[model samples]
Target: MTADGPADLSGLKIDRDAPPPETGRLRRVLLWGAVTVLALGGAVLAYRAANPASVPVAVARAEPLGGVPGAGATEILTANGYVVARQRASVSTEVAGRLNQLFVEEGSRVRKGQVLGVLQNADQKSALASAHAALASAEAREAEAAANARETSLARGRAQQLHAKGLVSQAELDQAVASDDVARARVKSAEAEVRSTAARVESAQVDYDKTFIRAPFAGAVLRKEAEVGEIVSPIPSSGGLTRGAIVTMANLATLEVEADVNEGYVSRVHEGMRAEITLDAYPDERFPGHVRQIVPTADRQKATVLVKVAFDRLDARVLPEMGIKTSFLADSPATGSAAGTTAVAAAVAIPKRAVREADGRAVVYVVEGGRAVMRGVSPRPLAGDRVAVSAGLAPGELVIVEAPSTLGDKSRVRVK
Candidate 1:
């Protein structure tokens, strides 16, 4: 280390041999500036190679379109829906009692008037027997009263004879007459008893009949709530009704699809509108149906109207509680199938990737005369592969399938 700058310069001996030493910040700055400019130019060249302003694209001829927007185009819509059985009912007991016997199980086919189950009826039996006995006694009494009435007439006749012949005292004759009157009253009393007992018999028979529960309609039993010997009661519980359905039965033939239609369009829907139904379980197949009913009531909260659809032809695969999608073609169909005209066959299609939104309109880049051009078009679904063009582009006009970022009107393009 040198103590002073003057001592170090003497030992270094001037390498004046090393040409005149460079000096001045301005000259050094200028030298660096040139090197930086060369480096920037090289970088710009590399970037041009990485991302070119002009992109290569493909071109294809547009198809001839009919006067119609596009031939064979389909307009698809999506809506949430649910499926339900048309004929549904809860089988409940009319009276409370212990279940005595259950013949049918869940999913059992039952006929109208078929015995589904029986309720414990020891009390009913007693009531019926008592009623029958009372009825019989009343009948016997009525018959006896009629005979007494006849006998009383004879007694009156005898009494009259006694009075006329003076064979008996006036007081004795009066007593005979009073006895005949009492017999007549007894006959009237027996007749009243018979009438009352007949009513009791009818009531008792009804109670007895109720003990054996029978099917109200011909259908299948979907569920069973009571088992043999189970003490079931229709009493109120936490749910307000302790007795649930004894069994669920449905007339499968009367089954229908119930769906909610938007209230805005419900007014247009009417009875007899043809419908296309597709089950979630069967995606490929579509079943035919007709609008059987449109519920007059609307669900105000949901703003939807309930529509009931009946099958035109029943399929064995169709069952209750399957999810379904219903398509309504029109409010009123003209004739034949209501699916509509086939527009998907004659339309020219393009991938959505090839389209772009510009100036608040749907547009696509068309390559024509060695340049990129924009064409406004209305797109509709076609064969699931591409959307058909409705307007603006003509047949045999080449369009850029893939749009380039730097592309513009009359922009040079290399077709790939």
Candidate 2:
């Protein structure tokens, strides 16, 4: 039976497994899935690293329109100019002399008639003293002449009385009268000498006072042109070490802007015209001003007229010769008769270039913490290249001007 069973089993075929284990199949699928996912993640990281979302743009600060006088006024013309003080002067001595003492320095506030410098007055002082002595001597000589004239007249009267009593001859009376006349003439000559000396004393005093340099007006000293021991003169010197002025000063209260208007636009400007002044040093600050004067002359070469504009209220920030830009406005009686008196509608204004159209809406990219935040704004037209944002912006916010096409909400930006 065992031999027959073995022979039959050898003829029969055995059942074998045709598919791999289910666990092995599942493991292979998962390994490929992980590799694909890792590859995709790496690709994403590489793309992001190579291309950043940051954009470069120019930026401008949103400013309040109310603070800018004549912002709403119709600007007829614009011009560039310089700030100048109407009462500016270079203080110098009336007479040339070496400076002995300097009482003021640059930036020193001086009052009218205050001594700014004292010239070497040793010679002047000696001359003044000599003058005073001469005056005193003249006065004493005048008294002496009066006393001598009186005494001679009395002696002549006594001689006349004796001659009338027949105690003397007619010749003696004549002689007495001649003696009195001579004495009187001598007294007159002495009086003339006294008057001449007195005039000389006065002239000397005036010359002495000329040595002290005094401020002509109340102002701040802008420059110290002469130092102690330096020669200062009324006239400029080209020969030696002499300065024409001891100090240059200006009245800060009289600060004004002198702008040159193109001859074509000169008709738009007139005396008392309201203007908005912006200083180059303080671009954001606008000052209210009025046309003070139109210089009668014009520059033929530049074809420009010089217009002087005075500030409504002088500020300490304003200085002489500072560069400024001015906007001359058309008459707006409803706004106000004078500049800085009008109450304008409060709005935040930015450069027109800062605004962009996004999806049929006006948008501005505001920069905050180096990131651009998109804001929907309702814009209105403003003077010049400015847009007044009536609905959406606040004053002092930075808006991106010349925004790049790729700029988006919360995009990183580098302000140029």
Candidate 3:
């Protein structure tokens, strides 16, 4: 402390009025208040940056003004499908020979009678002609036999007349009768020979026809396995002398998806249920089809029922033996389109994020009038990213796709 003065006024110091000091209690209160405000502001900013709730959404979500049936409906099950037709077959014949001529190449359009190929049949053709000539000869013989039988009948009659007049003996009459009987026998033999010749002709004709292979149906040739002059035969042990085939023709319109429905889901897959086929070849487009038949028998080996979905339209790109994915739309459109001729019912489904557990209850935050309204919910099955909603959620209801902690009744939200 300075000894002389209550207030030191040094030569360097001038008298200046100073603000009054605040009361101790008020000063402490004001300091604390200021600290509290700053702390509160800092905490709010931090929280707004850290949490999704405070994130400013550029697009306002369409609020679920009200709940409707299927507000959060989701698909419970899903399966892939392939576009296909109902009638398809791989044609093979018992006849085998050297492939003499291939009438069609791969991708050639053909009619039912259009010959796909012809096999070497020089021997068969010659046999047919010979058999036919023999048949003609036999027919002539049959006619000659009839003439001889009539002549013998007349001779026997004349001999009988002579005997009656005593101009011919009984032995002569008997001889005439025998001669007539022999002529009848010749006629019978001739008839029999004719039948035999006819049989030969038919057999030869079959062999000749087999040599000229014909298409079984109207379709496009999918593959050509042989070239003209290539030796081919259907002989099983011919050491592959049987070149695979002259041509593989398929009615593309007859394509069908052979789907093996899981035995568990087969019961619901009755014939006439719609199906959508999306071929990997055409991913963006959907093909419409219908279940033509459900095999009553299940595959004992695979435990699945074969569901045949037939496409209504034919496309050149669609070929047999292609891998496919089929989806049964929940409410599949029945009508057809250029995109496809297939349709399937989609299963009830919902977004994966809408379902959550709160207070030990599986719940969904359904938006009602722009606010998150919590509701009790259940899920049927877990699917890709989405759960099939069994209860408490309806289709078309606005729900929070992103689940946030503390998301409950009356929470304000901005939906994407």
Give the total clashing residue pairs for model 1: 7
Better of 1 and 3 by TM-score: 1
Please say which candidate is ahead in lDDT: 2 or 3. Answer: 2
What TM-score fits each model?
A: 0.57, 0.62, 0.55
- Cα lDDT tens digits for candidate 3, 289-367: 5678877898789787877877644455667777777654334235578997753222235655666787897876766
Worst 10 residues of 2 by lDDT: 64-73
| Overall lDDT per candidate, in order of appearance | 0.72, 0.83, 0.67
Models ranked on TM-score? 2, 1, 3
lDDT of 3 at 391: 53
Lowest-lDDT window of 10 residues in candidate 3?
A: 60-69
Worst 10 residues of 1 by lDDT: 69-78
Which residue pairs does candidate 1 place in steric collision? 71-343, 72-343, 72-344, 72-345, 73-343, 73-344, 86-256
Candidate 2 residues lying further than 4 Å off, grouped into runs, are 1-72, 331-416
**Which segments of model 3 are wrong by more than 4 Å?**
1-76, 84-86, 235-239, 259-270, 293-306, 312-323, 331-416
> Clashes in candidate 3: how many?
40
